[model samples]
Target chain A: MEEKPVRLDPWASAVKLEYDKLFRYFGIKPFQEVLPRVSQVFGDPLHLMRRGVIFGHRDYDKILEAYKSGERVALVTGFMPSGKFHFGHKMVADQIIYYQKLGFEIFIVIADAEAYAVRKLDRKKVIEIGLYEYVANLIALGLEKNKHTHIYFQTNYEKPYYRLIQMFSRKITMAEMEAIYGDLEPGKVVAALTQAADILHPQLEYFGGFKYVVVPVGADQDPHIRFTRDIADRFENELGLRRPASTYHRFQTGLDGNKMSSSRPDYTIFLSDPVDVAVRKLKRALTGGRATVEEQRRLGGVPENCTIYEFYVYHLLQDDRELARIYSECKEGRLLCGPDKQYAAELLAKFLEEHQRRLEKARDRVLDYVEPPEF
Target chain B: MEEKPVRLDPWASAVKLEYDKLFRYFGIKPFQEVLPRVSQVFGDPLHLMRRGVIFGHRDYDKILEAYKSGERVALVTGFMPSGKFHFGHKMVADQIIYYQKLGFEIFIVIADAEAYAVRKLDRKKVIEIGLYEYVANLIALGLEKNKHTHIYFQTNYEKPYYRLIQMFSRKITMAEMEAIYGDLEPGKVVAALTQAADILHPQLEYFGGFKYVVVPVGADQDPHIRFTRDIADRFENELGLRRPASTYHRFQTGLDGNKMSSSRPDYTIFLSDPVDVAVRKLKRALTGGRATVEEQRRLGGVPENCTIYEFYVYHLLQDDRELARIYSECKEGRLLCGPDKQYAAELLAKFLEEHQRRLEKARDRVLDYVEPPEF
Candidate 1:
């Protein structure tokens, strides 16, 4: 039987993503030149890279060349402070931390203005969430607090940044904007303009001008990346900016076997969830197990269809040998579904307990990473 | 013979403004309550008001009530800093100065962002023109150099001002923007957004919130006023801002009997022009005269159609008796067009010479009026 098609828009929760098909659809080159470079640059490929979760890129060679030339490259990945800060958001943070370890400058833009415009949230509430939830979680996730790491609120970085947004708005037409983001409202259009400004403003003359800047994003955010790259090209003569580079990563699947989303609390394991809440959520999660333990043992479980297996492969399992052992055991019927879920819940509980403790400390120092742009 | 219909839009330069029809078309009420109220408010009505040049208004009753109740009202009149600062711009400055004397707070916005976006001018060049030509000329025209008078560049005031602009963009739609400015490019849309921001930003909570604001504009700029008033109403529930009030003034007729514009250099005597240049320009101006001096003496010249006569009535002669005498002399064969042009040229030269001297002093003190907004 032919498989059903999956939807992949950014806002939907039920959209299933197929990485290889999406790479072809978006015209992104596969991340296949990873063998020698991964060893040379990272000593070993990161977990996300080794597992092919970050599957494609555009203009990434420019970033690699900048790194090889002993020149630093900047990384930008902004988040709208609208929904719950969840593990799905953590995927980008993970790559950002890896990039930070490789001596890349990191910029975290808390897109509070987008939240205000698109979500109709008040500025005060957006700012509160950006500080207490998103910034705190990002710091806990290993985003360094130094000159190389700059966090900023989109609405607050208005001086040169907003001026640049207005300038970029001139470079694009309403028809081009509609082509990229279909039938957008004025707020969404402004939000898209602001996002382009967020991506390219760091390359401005005062901010060291343009050499190479990389953005690590999920496949759904490719439109913003494409739009920014077009803007960078149009501004090539005037602003002297290089087209921005970006890597596309796969979306984290939800507990219900759909795409993870903050809008559905049951489907998302929020970064700030308490240990017991996370444990309860994992226990009730949907799995690709048989109806009976005896049948599960006989049939072996379909680990490829299991959210628990995905959590282990993507998040919790750091040891290659242990991950291989779990995979083989599930396929050979040596491991049962109940025990596997229990093990996953315990691992998540331990992680959440430690993360919550670190988040408290991170909250106190989050503001240190927020750099207000000079006038 | 039937008269030709007038064309009036913000971008055109050949519009013949029929004030009564325009007031009715733009939904502005005629200024018919000009009895004792004018003398009571302004001591004696300014020449623009006395001559019916300040002809119509919207929500102007709110401004009058605010003034009567001893509440301070604000006046905002922003100009795009793209062209020569001419006498056409001076009409708005003259009104601002009049309001300044009546204890009204004045805000003059140098719309440099709009110039950069719509005219594609560089930021540095726009800023230079804004300060040296526009702001200095306004100061020379009697805009006060006090705390009550604030002048700002739209791009430079990006922090709180741009945030307010993003907020307003959410309140409006592409359809609405198209309705106001038909089929605008993204640049012009942004310029329109920036203009609305310039109009409403002074009422932000940090800038003393909203009570009443009055914009002095020509008949053509009624679109911006109308658009901003709609935004003010849309944001009423959330921001509690009062609708902005506006008064419409007639456009100054060019020397060639067209609408005055800086793009046509021969038609405009720039504020920065030398006294000799102003005199030369007036000598070559269009006038309502017959084929010969004898025929003009017999038919009597039409002072109403003479640009030199308008220069005296609007800019040069402040004495009512002298202005009336000049008007009748040109109409009743007592004065010829050549001598009238020479007298008007001399009057303009003397005024411009003194104005240039004051402008030099104003240049050193322009920063006093440039208040960077605090969010």
Candidate 2:
């Protein structure tokens, strides 16, 4: 029998996330069965699903049904613009782009309010950084700027949004707030409600009320999804709100083979990182090789513990058969860490060049994608 | 030694308010010295100040200094539209009118946000009742609608106001929120911050930042005033905000002799109350009188405990000498309960008729007095 690792709070740094255990721990259903069916609906599942990054879900069957029926639905996700945009952020961007292509209404909330409240950034700076660092990167990653997509700052959507926050607040109590977000600072209280507002705003009457909604998030953000789902349930009878479905993706490993932390520049390959810098970072990244190249050839390697391998699985590789071959080669000592690192670096540099090109284009028409509260 | 009656939470029904004890209990400075001086500046002060209804203050000297120097200052107060407008509401209205005449810029917030958050009223209904029952009554009570006066709903002024609230929330913590409002429901948390925003809003750049400001509120609302003043102090270094000054009023006693409650309609003489209903309610009111008329002549009436006497002092009489005579007559047993009740009934009826006339006119052009947020 395999010994299971104890998963700590998902938000903590010690969380060496065992994604399979999280479904049972969080009382969420696994997404394994739904992926193939959803793939059939979308013709081909995105690389996130093909690579098994999206491992868990809650109420995702409703979303699958909406997709099958060609229902106008929404994909709601938010970003706190407090730090550099990295591969961890790219995971959400990729999912947003993939889902938008599938005709889902997209609401990308640049949580300027949350940035100001929880992260202590000024609203103007949050907006400026959000547009340049996060939103620009998102648009670069092919999040379409069209009528169906809305990217808004949390502070700008004040009128209908705050009133709607007030409405959601009626169901939530202080005890619940403390439970969801410990120690309940005033900013955290506002941020939590504002997030609930962000999730629910897409379903407001002006945006076409009462439709299936889904959020794509790393496992750390499940608490907010759970809180929002509870709020949606509270409004189900009155506002006809659907409890939001969520798909939880595995955390993208940092260049150091630890969880990506924005505070540690060496740990993240920021999207804005120069191609040379990214290549340098990847070259120095922790890998799964043994002490000597001869020993790695004899005893094989641990791709599971390799940040370079994770970069390939997460961002670089697209073909499932090719990824499988690389995994087997690492396990069997056919591949060396040196060449694997070099290959991943080249792939990253190429990806960054393309993204930077799109980012430049995204800068010009940024306003076309930005939206205010519909009400 | 004088026996002190236990006063319940002023927001609750069991409050048998011993108004004098409130100064020591709330740690507020007595307004006795300030009153006569303010009276000299504003010509006999308002009847509320003359009769000692305005008993305590925090930094009210700033207001007096503004008056003496002819400074363009602000008076900020808010009303919760939870019920019909009554004499308790009238106390704040009377002060707004008095200060407006003294050349202070007046900002009256119809707290539709607070009414929804704290009172659980629907926003639409709160707006409707706020206009018909509260704002209309304030206009009827001689609160002038001019370029210097701005009346607005808390919900309508969402943009700059919420950003300002975000600014205020940075200084206020969850512990302070619980201390001020107790139990810390999400609605109360937002409501508390909204009030801080309301007070600080008058000192914003658009309204002329940093001048003398005062809010006239019942003693129960002193917590919000205290909270806002602390927030104002926190911003004083950066924003040049003056710590808000406040004048606290004693609660208006109901016909049943407890503090007036919005839920206990029978205990209140609503400003919209019909003449016959007002007269009937007055007839059935509690009075500080002897059981028999002959015994009342020997003992005299306790004007201190008389609801009829309180009605006259708080709302009915404008002349200080006339009010003094009524107090003397009640103390001398010349003003018996039946006759005192009858006299108050006539005064209330006449006041209501004149108020109804103004309310009719205020109803027609109510929007002219209302303003959106400047920012």
**Candidate 1, clashing residue pairs?**
none
lDDT tens per residue, model 2, A1-375: 132332211122222256646766787777766878887788788887766777778888888888788786889998888888898899888899988988888988988777777888765666777878888788788877778888887767647666677677677888987887888888888888888888887887766566688998888888888898889888787667778899988888877777797888887889888889889988999998999989999878877778888888789998777787788778778899988888888889999999888888887766677743211
Worst 10 residues of 2 chain A by lDDT: A6-15
lDDT (0 to 1) per candidate:
0.78, 0.78
Model 1 TM-score relative to the real fold: 0.90
What candidate 1 gets wrong by more than 4 Å, as runs, is: A1-17, A21-26, A208-211, A290-299, A364-375, B1-17, B32-35, B360-375
What is the lDDT for A111 in model 1?
86
Number of clashing pairs, model 1? Answer: 0
Supply every candidate's count of residue pairs whose N, Cα or C atoms clash at under 3 angstroms. 0, 0
Interface RMSD of each: 1.7, 1.6
Compared with the true structure, model 2 gives a TM-score of: 0.89
Write down the DockQ of candidate 2: 0.45
Kindly report the interface RMSD of candidate 2, rounded to 1 decimal: 1.6
lDDT for each residue of candidate 2 in B106-176, tens digit (9 for 90 to 100): 98888877777677776667788777888788877887778889888776764667767666666778888
Best by TM-score: 1
Tell me how far the alpha carbon of residue B54 in candidate 1 is from the true structure, in angstroms, after superposition: 1.3
